[model samples]
Target: MPIQKVTRDEILQKALGVFKRQGYHRTTMDDLARACGLLKGSFYYYFDSKETLMKEVLWWVNRTSEQRIFSVAYQHELPPDERLGLFLDRLYAAVLVSEGGCIMGNTVLETAMITDEFKEPMLVFFTNWTNAVAHIYETAYPTAQALKLAQQLAAEIEGSLLLVKLGSPESLLRDCRERAINRLNVPMHDCTSNP
Candidate 1:
């Protein structure tokens, strides 16, 4: 009998969970197959190799995150900082809590040493995201300055997410953000007002 199309989505979703937990280099095709309740041969039928599955999973993660952040950034009802904060909060919840970290960050950390192909997409995602952040900062700062600050903030946030995965307490991240918020001179009252 032909299996349902939903089964493939289920397998991919489960594979994503395993990949998120064990990371790209650490996870084997067997691991993903087991997580998806499929035999290794069956898994191979759906995905040619572990790398192919990983690339698709990482792309899904990036696409979902981009949509969420873009939704907040483009929404007219919310101010820039408020929208950014909402996005960040979603980020913290999505990547930081037990799932360990962002899939792009995880992919970069593990495969960056091994392959250029993996790093390319991660770079593009960061470039676009950092540009969006810079645009938001432009509401308060000069364009050039905002772009510089956005790069710095993007680096800081990515590093902080890595640290969170490494088991540093959340307060350390919050402290870093507080210091950054001060340095950016974004009014604190605005966060409370919009939230």
Candidate 2:
């Protein structure tokens, strides 16, 4: 019989789905090991503790998001509206519309208030997301206004995602995407000069 060797990325990818489905506290190391096709002790070989694995998972999600989703905002050739659409589409595919629905947000809600362990990596996920959206919005709005709008949009989208899981109409997200893109679709107004 041949022994199968699993890479860390392979484990993280599989474990991501489990964490997304079960969340941090509810998911046990055994569950993660099973998901990775390893025994519980074997799982320890990859991660010293469950929290350590989860912290790595959080950062892994952040890095994956930066590569697959947030990078859309920096495509200089694309117009703001198009870039925003691509960004939202990728986000929707990655987490928003997936069965688990926003792993980072879910973990933050489940873990942030009680334990600070997951805070740093999760902050990177959100901060990078906000910065990406702000970059897109900056195409049309002032820097401060862009950041404000990006923050507002992020809050709205995250809240709406929960509402979506609770049987709210999917249009809630459509409305969010449309409003964000619409805001960027317009020309930026200058308050300091010109009539």
Candidate 3:
């Protein structure tokens, strides 16, 4: 059999798991190396430092998540409300599959006091993601109103997911979906348009 090339992605994927479970500050480079089945010195051959590895991990996770969110958002030809619901379903599924618990948010919470490198990337990620979702919401509502709605809805979903992960409370996810739908269905100009 041809030798399976162990790439940097393969190493980062392993490191992501440890970071996901333990958070950034709690997880060590040694833990990442051990999880990846590599010696510390060998791991250094691939990454210059732990912060460098984390930067790559953040980029990889955000890129992966962006594709997933965009795919779900674009695939639906339905109304904006329905499309948003489907997008949420896809996003939550992607989060679970990635096992990273909102990589941008996770890093923000874990490293807020430590470094600007982590915080700056996270801000950009959230801004881009919220803007993308707002674009979809704008299709149904006035463009002027879509930004606030998108920001609120994204915050709700992200917070709900964190709660779910911390408490294993599935109902929180359902509650967030319900609240989002209620808020999204309201007209930007008139709250009673649907009725």
Candidate 4:
């Protein structure tokens, strides 16, 4: 018999969905394996343990955000407001906001206190996100104020995502997007505009 070859990327893609939907503690190796279309034993060929796989997943999430989400913040060709809008749009699409809540947010809430391994990656992910928003806010306000507003935007978005999960309304994300743009005094425009 031949051992099946699975790329790390393939495993992470499927594992991310499982973790996002089922969370860390509740998700088993079998669950991740099944998500990857591998048997439990075969899963070990790719990862030593769930924690190792999860750490890789977090790294994968961070890399994806850097490439797709955070990169929008650095688009100097776009106006700050447009950059911010595009950033939110990319974030919504990347997280598949309609299907499952933010994976990083869910993972942090589920594992922040219990797992030391997740701490640094979570912090790095959030700090980068905050800085990206803050850079946009800085265009209109002082540095300290910009950072404060950025932090507020981050919190509001996370809370809005929670609201979405609570059956409040799908429009909650749009409302948050509007509030963020309004709070920053950015001209009202379609956040869904392509970057």
**Top-lDDT structure, candidate number:** 2
Write model 1 residue lDDT over 1-195, tens digit each, in one string: 333344766776677778778888789988887777677777778889887777777666667667876456566587765766775676677676557567777778788988986776688777777777777677767677777877887778878877776788778667655654454455544433321
Off by over 4 Å in 4: 1-4, 186-195
- What lDDT would candidate 1 get against the real structure? 0.71
> Would you estimate the TM-scores of all the predictions?
0.82, 0.92, 0.84, 0.90
- Cα misplacement distance, residue 34 of candidate 3 (Å): 1.4
lDDT of 4 by residue, 59-168 (tens): 89999999999989889899887898899989988776445679889988998888688888888899999998888877767677678778888888888888878888
What order do candidates take by TM-score, descending?
Answer: 2, 4, 3, 1
State in Å the error of residue 162, model 2. Answer: 0.4
* Number of the predicted model whose TM-score against the real structure is largest: 2
- Which pairs of residues have clashing backbones in candidate 4? none
Which residue window of length 10 is worst by lDDT in model 2? 186-195
- The better candidate by lDDT, 2 or 4, is 2
- Write down the worst ten-residue block by lDDT for model 3: 186-195
Name model 1 segments beyond 4 Å from true: 1-8, 179-195
In angstroms, how far off is 188's CA in candidate 1? 16
Candidate order, lDDT descending: 2, 4, 3, 1
CA shift of 121, model 2, Å: 0.8
The whole-model lDDT of each prediction reads 0.71, 0.86, 0.74, 0.83
